[model samples]
Target: MHEKNAGQNKGERHLMMQGKLNRGPIEFKSRPAERTGAIMAISTTNVVCVPPTMSICDGVSTMTREGFRRLPITDAGSGQLRGIITVSDIVDFMGGGDRYNLVKNKHQGNFLSAINESLRSIMTEQVMTLRENDDIEDAIDLIVNKRHGGAPIIDDESGVVGMVTEHDLLKALFQGQSLLSVEDVMSGSPRVTNPDCSIAAVAQQMNKYHFRRLPVVSDDVLFGIVTATDIMKYIGSGEVFRKIQSGDVSEVTALPIRSIMTGSLQTTTPEKSINDIAREMVQKRIGAFPVTEDARLIGMITEFDLVRTLASR
Candidate 1:
């Protein structure tokens, strides 16, 4: 089975290295230093935000429709940091059947009323926050370690000032800014595959989509991730698969994906700080980490994504 998969993977890599997918039509060639300079110069006044009393429904509606993940929740009266509403938070609430049912039943009300019914009851406090002068590294750490998607930028008085989301992080990376969030460069609805699927099948999908990794899922639960590196390792190891020119094997056909996949995994939550996550990636020498809530996969963050964020900064 390994040998059969190896042959298929070799073909996939050849195509990829040949630029057969044409995935980089918009590629930017700028270096990281230049991108960082651009992010540092961006003014904070234009950041996206919201008030704490605002309903979760409203936050979700705005964020979902606008493709945002973090909504800065401030005290309506004082404009002070109260909490934050993130896509992961909303997903958690939705997973708790009762809240999901309630929200589904009341989707058509006025924004405020819908928020009152669906979000206000489920929103979280104890928000992780950052100050304006805080280094970008600080925010990155919070997102990576804490699994936070965004952090509300506050002042010495604790008044809500500006907001930063993963999108902002991506902007920083792509443009060379100081700090960034998960929302900054996370690709929504990324390609995924089952852990039991054949490497050949996965390789085909990766080649087709021009993806670097595929999140591994089992029974709708995120297990780990498989990347080009995994395939390359299997090939270079030689022991896993030997080159076969023409012989057909009848016995090696039913192998499960778990047999070849890396099982022990590292993960992050949307609430973690990017700095912490980046550190883990460097220390662990891993390319990507899965994002989970309640042990279920929600997303995957990769070194490429981080690189993009750094480029934007």
Candidate 2:
């Protein structure tokens, strides 16, 4: 494995035991020019995937266990790529979008029964993928232009050979150039939420704005932050199952966002360089940082932002 050969860090080591590969906190040392090779140089090979016939609960359980935000579904017999499911899809099934119909109409408000349904019901049938021969620029274009979190790398037989994500690309390009500051790349005036927002409402906002994480503010002060991972954790932690006494998902989704919001935060200043922020992200295992100035929330920076910035370099 690339990670094994590269002397993977503690976080990657932990994930390795769970069959996950090529994730970081990987240290970025190679210059952008030297690392410009096949996308496989950075992509995660031997990725953990689930069969299409897997149950929804089992699929999500694997994701939660592996700390993966997305899982590719493959054909059991041939291992050909079939579909992909993400935490966003889980959020949607939990009342964020039309997929909630399975919980309401099909399962008749029975969360247990709904979760037992086949993974195919919620998996994204039309998946965007990457060819093994595709270069890094191709991956960058596909992710940035299409707004994909990641894509599976496939071979001539259309079988998944590896996986690449924004994190992988960021690690390859963040060479401490210090060319762009956080203010230059961060999305300003980010869509935010209040502590009182319902989990369902937070999910809706995430899907609506295409944001993975949202800053929680109240009275001009940052309270906490919530992300699709938080929602997925709520379900994966077995808290949702324990809380659902009558098998009604509404009981769990009705809880305020504050109940699940991450109170402790890691934030950054506007003047910080994207290079510095990228290093911190890898070291701290953080996906995004809320930009603060004088203790006030202003903007947000994430792997996507850094990837966009570094890809240009």
Q: Which of the numbered candidates is closest to the native, going by highest lDDT?
A: 2
Model 2: CA > 4 A from native: 1-36
Please report, as a residue range, the 10-residue window in candidate 1 with the lowest summed lDDT: 13-22
Q: Whole-model lDDT for model 1 versus the true structure?
A: 0.52
Tens-digit per-residue lDDT, 1-313, candidate 1: 0112344432222111111122222333344543223223432455456775565545666664554446666666777677666544443332222333443455431222333553456556787877777766665666555555567778888876666654455444433323444433445454566667665555556545555577776556666777654543442343233532222211111244455575487777665656666666766656677776566565667765785456333
Give lDDT tens digits, candidate 2, residues 226-250.
9898998888877788888888878
**Local error of candidate 2 at 147, Å?**
1.1
Q: How well does candidate 2 score on lDDT at residue 10?
A: 19
CA lDDT scores, all candidates in order: 0.52, 0.80
Candidate 2: worst 10 consecutive residues by lDDT?
11-20
Best candidate (score: TM-score): 2
Model 1 residue 277 CA deviation in Å: 19
